[model samples]
Target chain A: MEKKKTTIILFSGDYDKAMAAYIIANGAAAYDHEVTIFHTFWGLNALRKDENIEVKKGFMEKMFAKMMPRGADKMGLSKMHFAGMGPKMIKDVMKKHNAVPLPQLIEMAQEQDIKLVACTMTMDLLGLKEVELLDNIEYAGVAAYLADAEDGNVNLFI
Target chain B: MEKKKTTIILFSGDYDKAMAAYIIANGAAAYDHEVTIFHTFWGLNALRKDENIEVKKGFMEKMFAKMMPRGADKMGLSKMHFAGMGPKMIKDVMKKHNAVPLPQLIEMAQEQDIKLVACTMTMDLLGLKEVELLDNIEYAGVAAYLADAEDGNVNLFI
Candidate 1:
């Protein structure tokens, strides 16, 4: 029997949004589906390593790196961002509810062997070096994404 | 041969996000795919009528209605929303490029026979009434969305 395919385009940088993407990806993986999460634009922040990697970059790239969150744990909430308080509040609630944090959710996705692909085009635009991201993830462009999505049972742009 | 299906869960209320959703939906429709855009959460704002409707509502519902944009044209941008200036700049650029605005894209989707569905669960939660939305759209719940999406070639959450 053919396995069902799920492809998600993670395009938002918000912590809550990334959590949603990872949660969905993990769920699909648990269901024995082949899942691919293609991180693009601000979504690339989720894949960034917490420690900065010193690399040569253009002025715009440096500016973007400084402005964007270092990793998933540093990202903010999509709604009620209340001067960075919303993320803290949500994290507390998640802890109380025994909900998995975004970072752990991402780890679980990787453990499940759900393929993670970073958008190479956006990486160049944002000045993110390959060494700056988490290890073991593939890097590709839109053509690769479209090839996966065109036959996917669940193709989501999140 | 069975027609290819595309289903989108329009989850963001941002003007640019909604525009992206509509553009993809329109493109799928043009490609002769059966398409559905299931509006939920903030996505409901795009389906709202610009004119105010005097509907009875609880305090929370009224507050939600008041805070959300009345229609697609009034929604803010997801990125670079510099004190509401980003949307204006985008509109200017879109005008210069002769790009269709979000409202027209919705109209075009209708003309192409694409299905526009409002998530009834979220609509009730948000206290939006039927009269407050555009005519000729269907109201449904998650089951209906999943029914379409489980067989969909492209299922997006935007």
Candidate 2:
């Protein structure tokens, strides 16, 4: 029998939203399902690092990288974001709940061998370079995601 | 023949995200799928009206309703929100793309008889009252949503 397949399109880069996406992906993987998370657009921000890294890119792309949040810890909240404090409050709540932070969640997802594919189109559009992202991830476009989703029993956009 | 079920959990109340959710729900309904949008938490904000209406609620509830955006039109963007102006820019982009606004897309969903259910638990948490929300919608808890999702061919959270 074919293994149960779950394909998720993680489209939000907000800290809380990214947490939800990773939580679902980890849950599916725990159920013995083949899971794929296609990160696109702002979702790519979750993969960025806080420290500046040299990557050959145009002026605009480099500027985009500088402007956006470096990683999950630096991301803003989707709502109640009173400046940057909303994310801090939510992080405090998460710690209280014993929920792992977004970075840790991403590490767990990788440990589970869930396929994390960065959308190349978004990378080009946002001017994100591979050196800025964490290791152990694949790169693909919408066509690749569609091909995987077409065969999957479950498909989600988040 | 039974229609395929598509149940979406509208967890984010961001204007663009709500637009995406409604667009998907409308698309699924057009394809003859039984579509249900279970609005919960911040998602409930999309169903609110812009005008203030007197509703019988506790002090905390009323305060919540007052602080949050009344309707879909008043919602801010999930990201890049420059003091609430980011939504305006996105609306401009949507207009250029000839995409309908969130309110119109919602009307379209209702016209198609797509099931729009509000999460009671979230209502209690957020202090939203039915009087402040758009009419002709169902109210239910997670049990009801779970029942719908159990048979759903596609389930999404956004």
Candidate 3:
């Protein structure tokens, strides 16, 4: 039997959605599938540092970094977000359901040796610096994703 | 050659995320893959009728039905949804990009014979009636989804 491949395009920045992405990725890895998560655009927010990353950037880049969520913990809810309370509410619900937090899920995915890729084009467009992201991750462009996706047994854009 | 299978659990009701789900389903169907979209929980909102459904329900169910989005057209944005203007802004951007609207994408998926399954448990929990949904959709439980997913080449939760 050959090893199956799974490639995910993480495109949403919302906390709940990011949780879903990680849950699926982790599940796939558990099923013995080689999984790759390609983070792009808003999805890059999941990889950001929680604290202000001291990286030298241009004016617009600095502004973008300031405006966007610092990391997975800082992401907002997708909908029904009543004055920033919805995320807290959902987190409570998740805890009740024994679901792990999004940040921990990301760590688990890494521990499971799932390949995490950050989109370089999105980084350029959004002015995100490599120093601002989590360590031990791959960075590449769309072609790189397509190359993997074209042969992959499973491909998803979340 | 064997036909590939893809199953998507459409778990979010937000307009933009629903659009992404439909886009992926439509694309997969175009590629001649057997695709199944299992709409559950909040996802049932995407299948609702724009007008009052007029289904008799318990107090809580009625309240839920009233609170959720009526249909694809009435869905809120997943993020940055400020005073309902975010959806409008995104609609404009979609138009500029020549992206089809959510409702149209749903129609196209139906036309392409993609399997659209409304989760029966979710429907019961949310007080959604079949009469309130679009025509020609399947109703099933988690077993149905798991059956299709067991041999699926790709599985997604959006």
Candidate 4:
């Protein structure tokens, strides 16, 4: 079967886009197509091991401040969004829906063989050390995204 | 007066991002700032009057598909990552998080004077009609995004 080559470039870290990017990548995987997701800027947070990220208060806030993992305890989706409710509400929803949090989502992506790439330039500019990123994450540049996009992968700046 | 400019782009139909966009825009509005959202690709579905989405089946499948809108009823969210229960669980979590659904988020965006722009190129390529889009949605080109983005206002893609 001729598979559709697709690449989703996520330039965001917001929850909705993060979810959309994941869902789209999953759809591609389900279709048995080659898929790659390039995360940059706010998008880089998607590849982090952390969940329950707290958005910065405002301008001048450090990049990936809350998004970055504080440690294994705070890393890897330890906190799912309560959608603004307390942690208890977030947990309740998890129990009710049986939805896999971000960490699980990343695991599922890896298990499904979906490729995850991070933007090296953005990471460097933001002063992120590779060690600070998730273990499974791949680092690349615009050339990499272009290379994939040129392969007829659907390029999206999410 | 130097008005605060906030332009958030929505690229998927996921409830969380839509809700964030809504909340951020509303937040800006509350501060009397100008807010706008440019919707494209899957994000267009959020504005569709008839965006009736459905969840994918299977534990892995459902978890992966959780970020997508099953329909208008499931649009916008105050929560994220149902913690692996499923869509229903995700929704329950969303409710706990105080996340608004997509439709209500759209309504909120408008009520707060947030401009809604749809990417014309994407709509045509996707075979969508104006009717499929929500009312008051403006049709724009890449130039529009560039214009907005170049202005140095808060321009975010999703």
Best by DockQ: 1
lDDT of 4 by residue, B96-155 (tens): 998675567668777877888887754543345676567887898654654453333455
Candidate 3 residue-wise lDDT, B1-158, digit = tens: 98888899998998988988899899999999999999976788898878886778776566567668899999988788889889999999989999899999999999999999998755764567899998899999755665676568778877
In model 1, how large is the Cα lDDT of residue B147? Answer: 98
Q: Which residue ranges in model 3 land beyond 4 Å of their true spot?
A: B1-6, B11-35, B47-66, B70-158
**Model 2 lDDT tens row, B1-158:** 99999999898878888988999999999999999998976889989978889878765565567668889999878689888779889889989999899999999999999999998755755567788899999999755765676457988888
TM-scores for candidates 1 onward, in order: 0.63, 0.66, 0.68, 0.45
> Candidates 2 and 4: which is better by DockQ?
2
Instruction: Mark the regions of model 2 whose C-alpha exceeds 4 Å error after superposition.
Output: B1-3, B14-36, B44-66, B69-151, B154-158
CA error at residue A7 for candidate 1, angstroms:
2.8
Docking class of 3: incorrect
Give lDDT per model, in order. 0.88, 0.83, 0.84, 0.61
Q: Rounded to one decimal, what is candidate 1's iRMSD?
A: 4.8
* Per-prediction DockQ: 0.25, 0.21, 0.19, 0.07
Which residue window of length 10 is worst by lDDT in model 1 chain B?
B89-98
Model 4 DockQ (Cα-based): 0.07
lDDT of 3 by residue, A33-125 (tens): 788999999999999989887888899988888889999999997765668766775666556446688899999999999999999999998
Rank ordering of all candidates by lDDT, starting from the highest: 1, 3, 2, 4
True contacts kept of each: 0.49, 0.29, 0.14, 0.09
Cα shift from native, residue B19, model 1 (Å): 1.9
Task: For model 2, state the Cα shift of residue B138 in Å.
Answer: 12
Once model 2 is optimally superposed onto the true structure by TM-score, how far is the C-alpha of residue A39 displaced, in angstroms?
1.5
Off by over 4 Å in 4: A51-83, A86-94, B1-158
Docking class of 2: incorrect
